[model samples]
Target: MNITEKILARASGRQRVSPDDVVFANVDKVMVHDVSGPGVIKVFDKLKKQGINVDKLWDPTKVWVAEDHFVPSADKVSAENIVKLSNFTKNYGIEKHFKYGMGQYGICHTLSHEEALVLPGEVYVGGDSHTNTTGALGSFACGLGHTDVAYVLLNGKIWFKVPQTLYFKLNGKLPDHVMAKDFILKIIGDITTEGGAYKAMQFGGSGINEMSVESRLTLCNMTTEAGAKNGIVEPDQKVVDYLSSRGATNISLIKGDDDAEYEKIYEYEGSEMEPLIAKPFSPENISIVREAPSVELNKSYIGSCTGAKYEDLVAAAKILKGRTVKIRTEILPASISIYKRAMEDGLLKIFLDAGVTVGPPTCGACCGAHMGVLAKDEICISTTNRNFPGRMGHVDSQTYLSSPLVAAASAVTGKITDPRDLK
Candidate 1:
């Protein structure tokens, strides 16, 4: 069995399982954010009124809540939602809540890793689709709808149809100018957005082993753009060390069986890859940096669970060190802790000196909720997960997705310029 099947089987108390098999598995963790938590709480209330009383969550400690989607509240409604979430967490005894304006608050996925809430070989679920980002820790993490989340809260179990696994064998090392974002963009280009729907995308081989935990998280984070059920990488010493530094102990590591079944296998030579970009409107509409047309941008943004890690910001700061941005640009750290670290490291100073606005740690502009919403006909370059129409604001506004290196370089040049070209 593959890692996914093995984890599911163990959670379901079954000796073995196969693709498409329905199983009721115990959930080790459940995460809900302000955007989705209100809906879940509403459902829980509805259930109670129907005589299906759920006095409390299955395990309050195992459930985590974060107010991120519209932190600082973009509107009255957003504020009310946070209040609802706060009341629910307080009443339900959910001690793991990261409330708005709290020192520990951050994008849920980023905090989940920093807090070590999701561990290897565990079955976890979140209200947001990007929950798969946690799989970088070697956990079986995926997203569920609000109602589904409510069900898990009530019963501590959820049902799933096992997904077939697609193996990605990456080899060799990427160039200094290239990044996991470029590599993932290339994969989405090859497979198209819907290629891996209802399937598990398992990454392995020499290239993955050589990448840092941050880079690995970036890779797994975007698998949702390919419509995958989940994306995972086997845990190694690097992951164990990262978790340990965050106070995690007694971790359970799981690996794919040597004879694990896979629906298909794709191989790539990382050395041959270059910085790439996903053109306006679709993550799969990819083009090599040098080959892409000259596109002038009205704005550039570098932040999100997908691209706002410490390493990613450091890469951008290196390029923006003594330069000033030609267009409007914003840099937001994914978490409060990351923001503080960047400040101590002088990365935030570099960004400010470069004329980039450093904002609070919120989903903010990434989800078009606030901070940096786009105007009609505006063009922006961003280091974010999606480029769907109207994703960042107005329906006519366009967003091109790229690595932080590309985003920073383009901001300096005010055009779609390759980072290597600056060298």
Candidate 2:
């Protein structure tokens, strides 16, 4: 069995499981953000009104809630949604609620991993599609709809159809200017958007082993764009050390069996990869940074769970250290903790000195809810995930997706430029 299969099998109390096997597995944790929490609460209420008694969640400690999307209340509707989430969390006695502007708050995915709320070999679920981000820690995590979330909240279990696994074996050392974002973009370019539909993408080999936890998270986080059910990396010493630093103990590392069946296998040489850019409108429309059409930018943004990590910011700051951005630039740290660390390390100062506007830790602009919405005819070079039409603002606005390195370099030139050129 693959890692995903092993985790699901253990959770479902089965000795062995195969692809397409349906199982009602026990969940270790369930995460919900303000954007999706209200809908889940509504579903829970509707079920209760139908005479299904659910006075409390199956396990209050196991359910995590965070106010991220539309955070700081972008509008009246979003504010009302936060209110609903707050009321529900308080009334339900959920002790793990991270409210807006209170405590350690940030994007749910980043905060969850940083706080070690989810761990290896666990079966986890979140209301948002990027829940698969937690799979970087060796867990089997996936996204479900509000209805499925409500069911998990009430019963601590949810049904799942075992998915076929796709093996992505990454080898060779990465070039100095290449990053996990570039590698993932290369993979997406090869496989296309729907390539991994309903399958678990299991990453292995020396390249993944050499990557930091932040890189691994970014790698898994974007698999959702490829239509993957989940993206996972086998646990190693690096994972264990990260979890331990965050106070996680008793970690159980799970790996694929030697003869595990794979739906497909892809092998990539990290050293051969170059910085990649996903053109406007589709993540699969990728091109090498130097070869991509040279387009001017109105704004450059570096934020979101995918690109707002400490290492990502540091990389950007290194490029922007002695320069000023020709275009408007926004820098958002993934969480308050990350923000504080950046500040201490002078990364934030570097960004500010480069004429970059540093924003609070929120999913504000990434999802187009607030902070930095684009106007009509505007073009943005951003480090956020997704470049779908109207993703960051007006339907006519264009968003080109790239890594923080490329984003910072482009900001300095006000165009799609390569970071290596600056070097």
Deviation (Å) of 402 in candidate 1: 0.2
lDDT of 1 by residue, 1-423 (tens): 999999999999999999999999999999999988998988988998999988877899899998889987889999899888889999999999987576778899999888888899999999999999999999999999999999998889999999999988899888889999999899999999999898998888899999999998998899999999999999999999999998999987898788999999999998898999998899999998899888679999999999998899999998999999999999999988899999999999999999999998889988899999999999999999998898999989999999999999999999998997884
Clashing pairs in 2: none
Provide TM-scores for the models: 0.99, 0.98
Model 1 Cα shift for residue 97 (angstroms): 0.9
Every model's Cα RMSD, please? 0.9, 1.0
Determine the backbone clash count of candidate 2: 0
Q: What is the lDDT of candidate 1?
A: 0.92
Model 1 misplaced stretches (Cα beyond 4 Å): none
Worst 10 residues of 2 by lDDT: 95-104
Instruction: Indicate the TM-score of model 2.
Output: 0.98
